[model samples]
Target chain A: MSTIDPTGHPNVHQTAAELATGDKTDTLLQTDGLRKDFGGFTATDEVDFSVDAGELRCLIGPNGAGKSTLLKLVIGTYAPSAGSIYYNGRDITDLAPHRRVRRGISMKFQVPSVYGELTVRENARLPIQRFADGEERRRRVDDAIAAAGLTGYEDVAASVLSHGQQQQLEIGMAAALEPDLLLLDEPVAGLDVAEREAIAERIVRLNEEEDIAFVVIEHDTDFVASIADEVTVLHNGDVFREGPVEEIKADPDVQRIYLGDEQ
Target chain B: MVANTTDGAGSADAGGPMDALRRRIEGPNTVGNSRGFWIGFTVAVASLVAYPLAVGSYQASRFSLFLVYAFLGLSLSVVWGYAGVLSFGQVVFFGIAGYTFGIVSVNFATPLGITAAFLLGVMGSALVAAVLGYFMFYGGVRDVYVTIITLVSTLVLHTFMAQTAGDEWTIGTAALGGFNGMPTIPTLALGVGGAAFTFDSVTFYYFVLALLIATYLGLRAVVNSDYGRVMVAVREDEDRTRMFGYDVKRTKLAVFTLGGALAGLSGVLYASWGNYVSPQVFELAFASLPVIWVSVGGRKTLLGAVVATVGIEFVRNSLGGEWAFIAVGSLLLVFVLGLPGGIVPWIHRAYVDARGDATASNPPEAETVEVSD
Candidate 1:
């Protein structure tokens, strides 16, 4: 199980075995039978999923596919109606979002959450100060600013940031926490090609160099295909298919749900 | 993580000694700047030392009143500025403390010193605020609900105090003092060696100044600490702050209590200076006044709140009557509409711009660079 490579695609048997025995290396996060319901409507059905340490996994499906809901469940933003979530071999089903973050999990919202009245640096410094303290807080804030390519614009009010830059600053705030698992919801939702590429490249570099795990929710199939090692497709609050980018892209069910009958 | 190597930058910018002086006068660019801390500290000390000597007895008494108002404004700043809780009932705490002091001193004092009466009064008021804050903060009441609940609480307290004054079982009448308020309240006594010193207007001014300075420094420390950062983060984005491992309710409660205690302290000084306690102190108008002071002063800066309190009082005193109200009201409008950043930000901005350095006009730009990894 330890020798099974999680680089190209997931090995379900190995992943399941590792999850059962509470193995720490391959799985940074695992969800078993996770479910959520809003009123009578089920937003997330019973689901099983895992992301290996240092892997970039993308969650994709058409609108109303429960991708965002699943993300919320994983981060404890929304408590599961049933089922449990595990982070690094520990059950964290009841942990609060901030506690989850302190346990090395952080999420960037689809909408930019930077303080509009504060400068870009001040916005980033807030979370840095929250998650890190003393010298490390200052250092992480500086590093995040640099990583986001916001060097000279520190004093610029967050309100002044272009939409793309605001998105990058949100990512910078998450990265400043030095999370083991970073969840990004539609990171490039409003970016131009250049901005999207810059963000995509930063995501790739962070994954390769820092060995950070990521669970990204995006509608851009091409962007997901470019960065994702494993892609999971959700449909109607259930996992429709899960496999390597190429295989999932080629799957008939995935094509039916995402690309329509013409495909 | 980059090591901060900008420690020597303050001295290395030898554009001239004047440049360094300009930077010092301009204040720190960041909310968390050590230079800003020192400048605030120096100014606070100067105000404490100088104010009592500069004013005559009448003005000294007025300045004492201004300091008490400043304390109340500071309290509002903490709850509204740091925790993002707008409390409309703060004056109830002030009134409660004043009435408690009046009742206790008039009735219970031969047994307890006037000092004991004062302490109990302040503590009693703080206790009431804590009870209210727990329900407001931890009971899931937020924003407008919190504001309305507090305003309602103020109305209830005002009615209760007014009724208590009219009741036979209560101390009643001039003892608690209904509409007219209590008089002949004892002066705060201080002893050096074996001699006891009674506070005159000059002495009261210095004493209140010391308390104000202490409150300022203590609050400044809290605002700059890790806990302070958490409180401000809560203000900026509560969900994010909570996601960062803070118990938002607990932080809010703590700030509310601290603010309440400060308000009570102000109440003690107010009763001392006026020699009075009355239901009128708890009126809705008095309750709403500090909120305006905070808004006009600049919500984020403690010094700004104090300056606005004094400035507004000065304007009100010079003009008097309806014209005074109009003048202060007009200035408040100008501050709200024309200078929303408040007087302090304008002063800071002018000082920075006048330095005539490239970074001076754009200090935030420099801060941005320091943040870049």
Candidate 2:
């Protein structure tokens, strides 16, 4: 697993093994039979999910397909009604949100949720200060801002930034934590083509440079194609299909259920 | 993965509703540069130092009582303004301190006993706040419901304290005095028999003033620290802060307990200065007053709370208690409707605006480089 290449090379048999009982060193996050129900309605059904270290994965699903619910479950915002989640092979199904964060899992919400009352630097500094102090904290904050391409805007308040800038700031805050797995929900949901492309590039660069894994939820297939090494299609609270982007795109079921049956 | 994109150059500016509030609470920009702040500081210090000397002894004691009341205002500012926990039962802390001080001082009647009473009152209030706050915060009670719980708690405590006026209510030698209240309480003093220095003179007035100043500066420092920033962050968004790896419940509880301890300190001072302790401290009407003082002064700003408490208490004193209640109600309504940020924030904004105008008329030298080679 350590010798396995991360260059998106196709190794069909190896991919299958990685999914079942992921290599402990390579798997950053995994969920087994994860289930969540609100009353009689099941928001997430029996689902097994996994993300390898340093791999950029995209989640695509139609509305009510449980993309958001699954993210919530993995991030520990909502405890699973049944089943368990593991981070780096350790059971984390019952951990509280903050404890999960301390264990090197961080998330950006669907909305641009940076600390609006704080300056860009301060917003990023809050999480970085959790593990570091003094000069180390300051350097990490600077690096995170620069990684998000927000170096010049660090002194400004988060609220004044444009929608795209606000989104980047939230990403910067998550980066400051230096997490193993970063979950992004609709990271570029409301942005112009330029802004979306800029954010998409930043995510890819961060994945490559920092060697951090990302589980991104996005509706834009074109954007997903640009960055995702693997794509998982969620439908009706379960994994409908999962594979490399090209393979999933070419699959008949994915086209019929998700790609509008046109392809 | 394949991607190539670049960020567009844009100005970095932000002042959301809470950012302005953050500025008010932290005073990050206003204190150092604003001329009005220095002027106000000077006037406040000079007046505090001189007021007792100029006034009659009886009137001086009343001024000291106001200083003590300011402590409650500061506590509410911390809990409600900074931490965003609206507590209606702040007076309970004050009452606890008042009763504790009265009991300890009356029974023990020594310098060590007096010091111990202060510590116990504060710690006792903190313990109570921690337990109550744990239930409210950890049990998922939030926002207006937290307010409701605190308000209801205040009423229950007031009723329970009123009932303590019966003959069996004596704790140690100190009587619970029912609604009539504890009277002729021993004034705060040092030394034992002959040389004991009592604070019954104008010296007590200065003592409370000094304490108020120290508490004000201490609280300002706390809210401005990294811990304080996170406290404000939690207030702004609990889930977001938690996502960043902070124990939101624990943070809220810490601030709640700190506020309670501050209120407790003020309560003891009130009992010491006025030489009285009573169920009147926990009356529902009085219970609601701290919120008004903090709201009118500036919810998140300590100095604003102190100024508002003293100013409003002054008005209440001169206008007589009943009429003062009516006046406070009217002022609260006006403040809530027109000046939601409170007086200090309004002043800060006016200062910023005025400074903006001056800078705009004469733009500063180009601060940003056109291009980096």
Q: How high is the DockQ of candidate 2?
A: 0.33
Residue A84 alpha-carbon offset, candidate 2, angstroms: 0.8
- The TM-score obtained by model 2 is 0.88
lDDT of 1 by residue, A1-263 (tens): 45555555453324343547554666778889999999999988998888888889999999888998998898877989998888866678888787898899988767676776566666777777754765686677778888888888766667666777777888877776777899998989867799898989989988888888899998888898888879999998999888899898878878787766544
**In model 2, which regions exceed 4 Å deviation?**
A1-24, A255-263, B1-36, B190-196, B357-373
Q: Candidate 2 - CAPRI tier?
A: acceptable
Return the lDDT, model 2, position B302.
78
Candidate 2 structure quality by residue, lDDT tens digits, A192-240: 8998999999899889988878999998888999999799999889999
In angstroms, give how far residue A188 of model 1 lies from its true place. 1.4
Error of 2 at B188 (Å): 2.0
Clash list (residue pairs), candidate 1: A98-B243, A146-B373, A154-B368
Interface RMSD of each: 6.7, 8.1
Q: Single out the weakest 10-residue window by summed lDDT for candidate 1 chain A.
A: A8-17
